[model samples]
Target: MNIKTEFSDKTLTAIIEGDIDHHTAKGIRETIDLAVEEKNPSALTLDFGNVQFMDSSGIGLIMGRYRLMKLLNGNLELVNLPEHINRLISLSGLFSLDIIKNKGCEQIETRE
Candidate 1:
């Protein structure tokens, strides 16, 4: 998997590529965590436009990030999710916890 991160004053966006499974989850998690710790963004966005496959481990990664963001009193958002990955996220009930600002598109503010 390939992970690229962009940091702004209030947001950290991760552009993820390739499959997210047991093998790739650990590295992705660590990378994002490190960035979060260093940048301290108020929002975290995971862009999955280039991702092709995901498994249960993906859910774990999202959940972990959600918790981390909550601990920082921030928000977690998902963007550019493919259909199958969206289905997985929905089935995991992640939308209740994080914002799905866009699907395969740029992020938008959900609140005024």
Candidate 2:
């Protein structure tokens, strides 16, 4: 997977592309974590517009980030999720966190 990160003050957005499975989850995790720390972001937004496939590892990644954000007194949000991805996230009960639709770089509200 490829991760493109953008930061605005204490908020960081990560645009993720490609498949998010065991093969790519580690790299994504490391890259995103480093960026979050370097930026000291108080909120994280994940964009999955270009992601084609994901498995349980993707769930793990999201959960891990959620935990990290909570520890920092921040929040996590997701956008551009396709129907299948939305199903997975809902089944995994990630909706209680944050889930938004992509609308041309819109600034989504942070979720607790």
Candidate 3:
């Protein structure tokens, strides 16, 4: 997978592309972690809009980031999730903490 990062305010946006599988999840995790450590943002946005395919590894990757953000007292949000991917996240019970959105518009309301 390819990761593109952008920052606005204190939020770091990681735009992930390509298939996220076991072969790629580690690099993604490490890259994002490093970015977070360097940027020290208050929030992190994982843009999955360009991700073509995902498996269980994707869930693990996201959960890892969620835990990392928790330790930092920050937040993690998901943007531009496809229907199937959204369903996967919902089924995995990850939507409870992560905000899943479409076209930069968030459908899931988060209260914190």
lDDT per model vs. reference: 0.87, 0.83, 0.86
Q: Write the per-residue lDDT of candidate 1 for residues 23-76, one digit (tens) a residue.
A: 999999999999999999999999888898999899999999999999999999
Q: Residue 59 in candidate 2 has what lDDT?
A: 94
Per-model TM values vs. the true structure: 0.88, 0.85, 0.87
Per-prediction CA RMSD (Å): 5.8, 5.8, 4.9
Candidate 3, 12: how far from true, in Å? 0.4
Candidate 1 similarity to native, TM-score: 0.88
| Candidate 2 lDDT by residue in tens digits, 5-54 | 99987789999999999999999999899998888888899888889899
Q: Rank the candidates by lDDT, best first.
A: 1, 3, 2
Model 1: residues >4 Å from true position, as ranges?
Answer: 103-112
Q: Candidate 2, 64: how far from true, in Å?
A: 0.2
lDDT of prediction 1: 0.87
Model 3, span 1-112: residue lDDT tens: 4988888899999999999999999888888999999999999999998898999999999999988988999988888887667768877898677465567543543335
Least accurate stretch of 10 residues (summed lDDT) in model 1? Answer: 103-112
Which residue pairs clash in candidate 2?
A: none
